[model samples]
Target chain A: MDNQTKIHIKNLNLHIGKQQILKDINVQIPKNKITVILGPSGCGKTTLLKSLNRLTDIYPDIKVEGSIEIDGQDILKVKKRDVTDIRKKMGLLSQRPYPLPMSIYKNITYGLKISGRRRKRFLNKRVEHYLKQASLWDEVKDRLKDPASALSIGQQQRLCLARGLAVDPEIILADEPTSALDPVSSQAIEEKFVELKERYTIVMVTHVLRQARRIADHVVFMYLGEVVEQGSAEEVFGNPKEERTKAYLRGAFN
Target chain B: MKRFFKINRKIRNTFHKRWMLLSLIVVIAMPIVLGVGLYLKSAMLLEQTSLIKLLFSKEWKPMQGLFGLWPFIVSSLWVTILALLIAGPICLLAAIYMTQYTKKYFLRMMHPVIDILAGIPSVVYGVWGVIFVVPLVSNHLAPFFNTQSSGYSILTGAIVLAVMIIPFILNILIEVFRNIPDQLTEASLSLGATHWETVKHVLVRKAFPGIVSAFGLGISRAFGETIAVLMVVGNVTQIPKGIFQPGYPLPALIANNYGEMLSIPLYDSALMLSALVLFVVVLLFNFASRMAIIKLERHT
Candidate 1:
């Protein structure tokens, strides 16, 4: 219940069909900081990220147990209407950018318009504001009316980031958001996350150890669907208390 | 050894090339053969009355040797347009529901039923239309609208055509909707848009070209459907005054007159001309629809 804690997870468990995906998870994500969930592939990092926003609800026969309290509301117990409201409060940057089959400008404004911001001037201003925030304004300012899919993969991902931010979410859930991009685009996103940490809570999932090291303020190192270590990035990376954490940091089983 | 292998390859290549040429000629020649025959048969009619007069004039008395195609042309177009108006929205809604909203198990069950509906013979549709739809229109709809009570009319025919084409349209639209990548919907849903809103704004916009092609396919089917339409659309030759009145479409005219065409002077030629006209119109419609789909795709 600390004012600094944005999300408090307690005894979270997720099962898809007969297989357990996330086992007895518990963590605290702080406000205005980047929390990186670092693990090897298939270690449930992405599932953990998705769990925060209830995106895992789309999977069939999936059961989620325990509480994920965001802003004093246990999202698991909220009604469907309130779940949507909660989802709106969290921005999700997927691994691949899906630009809503619309013009670049419309992609940013769609969420704003749906939330009932209809003034032409307001929409125009926010479109510029968010695109700049995602660091894609200069590259795409001339093509605001063009189809978003026409952009390069890097630009598309940036556009998606701007789109997510347009909704004015308190938290940004990114699941390996730069895994599909080239290194340069990857660096651009990493820089954007570093700058955005002062304004919004960011929970990112990544299999790449280097990325986790580059941008993690808080680190949760997971293995085999269980959290092995959770602490400040410096403590976990510089001087790990757990032997498993030490092994993972040393690239024992990447 | 290399020369022997080379000769073997040459023999195989020559055989393949000859077979390809023969099949290609057969495919290309069939349509031309049919078109040529149709043109020759209609030549007599062209000689009897100018092509413009045949196409444009409304008057039609075979005994008096005046045959204008305005009535048949008008009836054919109106019936097809009406059928599309009724079927297009229903097919689109059903397709969207099946692809976007329905459970996987339910969609699996519904798909075969839709396919069977598409596979049903058109004659069966005509009979069903007569038994069920004609009465519904005459007993209920006619009384409700205060229109004429005849069970057979342009409206009745259109209703039958609409029923027959809905399944056809739905099948195409369902395929189009299914091809939309999962990431797009996930993005929309994650952004907090409702399922309906996602479908309306994202899925529909992405699938616009395919939807256009689906409608085009549906309209083309409705336009050319022969046996069932002939049975339902009351075959009077004058232009229909309203939906309740009997009308004569070109297919019904050709179907009713083709058998006795040889006995009547210029009748064979007129019937053949109508067939040719239907072919040309349907071809143009399909071609135009393809162009529209391409334009929309490029714009997106």
Candidate 2:
């Protein structure tokens, strides 16, 4: 109920068929700051991020029991017709960038067009604005008409970021967005996230502790589908309260 | 011991390589062998009449040795094109619905149905057309449209042919749609696009080359389908002016007249010429579609 909280999760449990994926998770994502969910692989970090925007509904036989409230509205309770509206308020960057099968210009304009922004002049301006926001304008401004797949992997990821930003979302949910990028691209993305957090709430998931330490303002450490510890970066990393958090930071387990 | 094993492995590798090379040679030689055989068999008719006269002239009197193939060629084109027009949209939409909108169990249920449809004999489809489609067209459709004719016509032939190829085209289309990666769909959906919009903008767009290739394969199959179309298309050797009118396609001509062709001089060769035409057209179509697919792949 804090004024600074952008998202509030209460008793969130998710199950796929007979196995539990996320169990009784209660957390608060703050406004205008980066909240990094740090965990080992297969610990449901990606699943938890997917749940924030109701992307979990895409899979069959996924049973979700909980309330995920964003700005005091329970997103999990929204009707199917209104789910797109909820999703529109959040931008998602997946593990690997998947550009739409289209030109670079069209990929950026796709979300705008779907949301009924069809003025050609306005769309042209927004495409440039988003590409610049993702730090890819200078390299790609000349070849906006080229197919997105023709770009290098680093440029494609930046294009995906620009495409996501073009939707004008309040929160950006990135699930290991730089895992597939080279170090240069990864640093470029990390710098963009740091700059972007000034205006947008970012909830990122990565198993790389170094990344979390570099940019995370708040850290949530998860182990085996449970949130073992969560606090500001200084509290969790500088002086850990939980034995598991200490063990993990000491390179005891991956 | 290791040296002895190495020598044995080298001999085995050579033997396997030669075996595979022999199979590859046979694969490459099949169409060439068939093309040569067909050309030799049909060369007699080619020698008797000019190719232009045989292809363009509408005269069909076998007694006088006049055998123009214009009517049969036009009829075949009409039937194949009409069938494609009818089945293309239906198959594409059904495939989209099955893959994108429906549940996994629903698609599972449809698999056996499609297999059964594909497995049924063409004769059965022909019989079904005679019993059902012919009457439906002759009684309800033609009368409603103010066309007065027997049910046996180009329209009936097309209807039957469309039904026969639905499974063939649908199977390929489903595979095409399925091959599109899930990440693309997720990217679109996360952008706040509806499922239908995502399918339209992403899935269908990505599957375009595959869809074109599937349609090309379907066209080749429909063009050569003999019994099903032969039964419904009234086998009159004339250019069909409209769908309601009866027309004779080339496959029907070859299949129906092949038994009696031996009695007439050059008659057997004429039928063989029709077979050659079918083979060449299909080969050319497959080649053209493969080129289109490759070009599109590069562009995308």
Question: Which candidate should be chosen as best, given lDDT against the real structure?
Answer: 2
Q: Write the per-residue lDDT of candidate 2 for residues A1-254, one digit (tens) a residue.
A: 98899999899999988899998999998999999999899999999998898888877767899999999999998998888998888888889999999999999999999999999999999999999999999999999999999999999999999999999999999999999999999999999999999999999999999999999999999999999999899999999999999999998888
Docking class of 2: medium
Please give the clash total of every predicted structure, in order: 0, 0
Worst 10 residues of 1 chain B by lDDT: B98-107
Candidate 1 local Cα displacement, residue B1, angstroms: 9.2
Those runs of model 1 whose alpha carbons end farther than 4 Å from true positions after fitting are A15-20, A57-63, A223-228, A238-254, B1-6
- In model 1, state the lDDT of residue B149: 58
- Please give the DockQ score of every candidate, comma-separated: 0.58, 0.64
Q: List the residue pairs that clash in candidate 1.
A: none
**Candidate 1 local accuracy as lDDT?**
0.88
Interface RMSD of 1: 1.9
Q: Model 2 lDDT vs. the true structure?
A: 0.92
Q: Candidate 2: where is the Cα deviation over 4 Å?
A: B1-16
**What does candidate 1's lDDT look like per residue over A51-81, in tens digits?**
8878766655568999999988899888766
